[model samples]
Target: MTLSTVNPDFWKGRRVLLTGHSGFKGAWAALWLCRMGAEVTGVSLPPEGNFSLYDSIKDQLTLNSNFIDIRDAEKLNAVVKKSNPEIILHMAAQALVRRSYREPVNTYETNVMGTANLLEAMRDLAELKAALIITSDKVYRNNEDGHAFRETDPLGGDDPYSASKAACEITTASFAKSFFNDKGIPIATARAGNVIGGGDFSEDRLIPDIWRAAREGESVTLRYPGATRPWQHVLESVSGYLVYLQALAGDDGAHLPKSLNFGPQGGEVVTVGEIALEVQKAFGIDSNWSLVNSAQPPEKSYLALDASLAHKALGWQSKWAPSETLTKTVEWYKAFSETPDIYSFTLSQIDEYEDIS
Candidate 1:
């Protein structure tokens, strides 16, 4: 069976409090929730980088946004209490690996402590039915293999950013054991790899950097041209998260105190150079790119996620293939390139994803 975009009434009148709703993936998820007819309350800091997807859809969606820091437990707790949300999706964190290297302390505080603060705040909320904590595929220790990372794989990270995410995973498991399992909250952790789509202007990411370079008539730079990853679209990961939530809300036994990995379809892994070539073709640009001249930070050479469990248990697999995902990404950037109407473009994609259901 294939996965389709969910119907609007599926989430009608449901309340969802999403932290870090202003980030790239979070913004896309927020727009989709609004389309699915959920009352969405967004809590996070203001947009920091270029044209933000959040800023684009703030007025269009039924969003109650509050500018605050997740690290501040007092503020976060107050907001969680006020919302009394039935579903919670925690996406707030310092997400960059290179940046984490630069600010290790901030990374730990935001990723680990921020998670603990949210779980603590939700502890007393009796109405809360399910909570999905968004972590990274990087949480697993990579031994430079093309094989996929499994759910029960060893959770360890060499770098500050990945290590901090690993810490969050441990905290989540401990919290679920200590309280959630018996309390019937049924918390789950999500780890998805290399999600790419529109409206992302973050640093140190591939698609955004490629888009920027192509727009400026310059070639993209690659530090690790041969590195490989599980490249999936944003909606692919979003669909898995929604299905997991649906299972948790329906049959608690299905998702009780568990962790799941969402990756692209089997045999979908592609090398960085191949993806760059596809991106160039999508952009229709003859622009060139080369390796970095100076030294670069060390990163894993290869990493992938074993999504077989998600397929077997949740019946969830990637809806869009890698080529389709890259095409969609290029299309979004092309629309923004021709006319920088980020708000309209973001809403259109949300509608597009929902219509697939």
Candidate 2:
């Protein structure tokens, strides 16, 4: 599905309620929705750092935004009631693994209970046609083998962040079956792989860490250099979400599945070390990385997702290969480092991505 083929009339004048609009992926989704002429209401906490994509584009686009935590059920419900949104895209969560180890209770409360609160609030909105709950690919149990995970794979997580997301999947399923399934509102959960993009200064992530190290004139540190993961551009995953939401809006929950995975193809899987080297070369920096020989929380050494279900069902496929993904990501950061107009640069990239299809 190319960008030209996407019907603009479908999203024009559509009311969308997006959670976590201040974060990396959420900000990208909000930008695309705004370009499509959707009336957007964003609910999320304030930006974690001084440099944020949300800050760059907030004034450029007209949107209804609130700085509220998802755990605040009373305020969240009130916002949802006031927005009267037709579509809900839930992306708010405690997304880091290392931080989860230090604050497990906070992770669970935000990921699991926060999801429940959103769904509960949506139950009364008669105009809501579809709700897509965004979860992580870490929800699957990893045996360190090379087998790619399927939708039917056993749901398990060793870390608090992953476990909380797994519990969210369960909660979304239960809510779908008990409440929305019969009420004519389609609720589905999306699990996406490791997403890399520009303007993401989140700590403990690969791309941001590499950019930081390069700026500081230091070598990049890797805790798990040899671990393999499915890597794709942020736009790829967000495109999949838009396609899934379009399907739900058109069908009204008649034939779509409850859960789907949006990830790279089989050949796009690469190791952490490979990503570091590729980014280094892309940014014209020397390759300098050292392995950390210290204790860290347990994480999967090998992880990948089988997106054949999404392909056969929704005609969704990743357009960018691993190498191209790296190049585009580095290019974005390099442009930002050289130019002051990040909002225009980002919109240009989005326009370029839309023309690719």
Candidate 3:
């Protein structure tokens, strides 16, 4: 099972509908697809904050941008009908755990029903060949047992965000069984671990917090410093999605995996505190962290994913090692500040990644 590198020939002139095109991972996916010559149509809410990655690179992306709430079924359906996309990459959702706690209704309405809306919109689109729903690694029924989760593990979520994603997985499965599979549309879900990369300035994330604190000459506060997580570069996870999507495009639904995990290999366990130190060192700064917290929400203490399924099925393995992931991610942020032409600089990184394969 040799999973080939993403083929520009396969993506060239392909019609793609990418949801959540303004978010961190969505922006990266849009960039990659646009570079590979896909006719991309993006559907997402406006990118927020003063330093949104999508805003910085939107001018560089050659795609049709549609600002619509996924929760609004009618509008989303209308957009999907007008675009008539062949492939749908459903990445739109309320993705923050802390935010989910505060806005449970919005989280459920978006992550759960929002996903349902996308599939429902595409129910009759004969042009749609395949769809890959992006979910999170936190969907497992983790009791801090220190065992890495596999595709068949029991799905559970203590938090609103993870629970909604788990529900999304179920919704996607039901749609496939009831409609899409019979229509020969290959639908699959990918559960990926935590990703660290450049151009991500979201609040409450480790890398952004470290970068912000260092810029202000302050110490980063860590609420879950002792927790262990499986972390990889954002490119690793995104590349896995593209490769998996390519496979689905070439195959029928029956024999392929319905769900899979994209994560780091074994022995990549790194704690939050360790990551903070490593990121600081990568940025050429001293490690300064505070272990104090005020009303930090509940999260998993130990999280890992067994990606052997992705390897054995698609022959996909992580390209960048842990240290290399840290270095390259830091390099991107540094270049974002120093390099005036951030678009070319970002594309250069993508070119470098493709060259690695």
Candidate 4:
């Protein structure tokens, strides 16, 4: 269940093309790859927020970062062709649910077409050994049932964001079967749970919203307090992807599963209200939340993932429990608020995670 399966030597001098390296999860992956001594080329738009993990570490790390949209097939293909990456990790997408509702076209273009563009671009790259397309646990159909979704669960989504990711799963699978399989290239899709961690300044997310409310000394708004999610640290999810990629590197397209779920253990599944309370406790702040009584866009009331396939296939499992995940998140924000050197603080957290995982 630990990160012993991640071989550091396997990444040294490896050519890796990472899309969406400007986002929260992508930044963490970029840093991890850099730490492993991988020759990394990051492609994505510039960081959206003023304070971003990508901005914090981009100057220090040796990464060839390109500011381009994944939806642009021409530009994406050019970058992919030039990099000639052996491994491609596609993380770029319109990730926010609320934003997806507001910009459905953008969501589909970025998540669905963006995935197709990445796969299409890979067709010319004869050097491509493997590719891991990052999708969401929301890709699974949720009927408000409490059952944890496995990799075989039917792909469905009610919201724009989830639907786009579900479409991505289908797109990746089609590409894998129709193209990559014949070319001896292994391609897989990773469905990870609701990821929470440091350096996430994104809007609408529970942790970031709570942190912002607390800092402003205002009550936080809860859209779906009773909604339950399978939560895990950023490191846990990133480690799962790394382990899955490593597995794909050696295997042919025949044996590897087309899709794998990477989520926390059973104990880590918790309600939104419970996580809010946990974050308040961790931050030593008085709990104040106001429920949105108005009608809003529909979202899954309950979501969890069964990552048994990843555990059995790649020897990967979540390391931190939900409580520790919240604690570490609070600590990171607190450190950033108090200290000027966020770069060092973020690196220390990564080092600590590796030590224990």
Q: Please report, in order, the local distance difference test score of every candidate based on alpha carbons.
A: 0.84, 0.88, 0.89, 0.88
Residue 225 in candidate 2 has what lDDT? 86
lDDT winner: 3
Over 130-239, each residue of candidate 4 has an lDDT whose tens digit, in order, gives: 99999999998888677899888898999899999999999998988898788778899999999999989998899988888888888878999999999999998898
Alpha-carbon error at 39 in model 1, in Å? Answer: 0.9
Ranking by lDDT: 3, 2, 4, 1
Q: Between candidates 1 and 3, which one is better according to TM-score? A: 3
* Candidate 2 Cα misplacement greater than 4 A, ranges: 1-6
What value does the lDDT take at residue 118 in candidate 3? 94
Could you give candidate 1's per-residue lDDT for residues 1-357 as a string of tens digits? 565345466578899999889998889888888877899898888888767767766777788898899899999999999999998888999999999989999999999999999999999997988889999999998887667899999999999999999999999989988988887778889999889998788888898888888778888888888888899889888878887777777664444437889898773678888898789878776855688999887889889888888877777787778878888888888887686566777677656665664
Q: What is the lDDT of residue 100 in candidate 1?
A: 91
| Tens-digit lDDT string for candidate 2 (231-330) | 9899988888888888887754558877899999763579999899888777666867888888988788999999878887788888888888888899
Q: What is the lDDT of candidate 1?
A: 0.84
How far is 356's C-alpha from truth in model 3 (Å)? Answer: 1.6
Off by over 4 Å in 1: 1-7, 253-257, 339-344, 351-357
Instruction: List ranges where model 4 is wrong by over 4 Å.
Output: 1-4, 251-254
lDDT of 4 at 50: 66
Tell me which of candidates 1 and 4 scores higher on TM-score: 4
TM-score of each: 0.95, 0.97, 0.98, 0.97
Best by TM-score: 3
Candidate 3 wrongly placed segments (more than 4 Å): 1-3
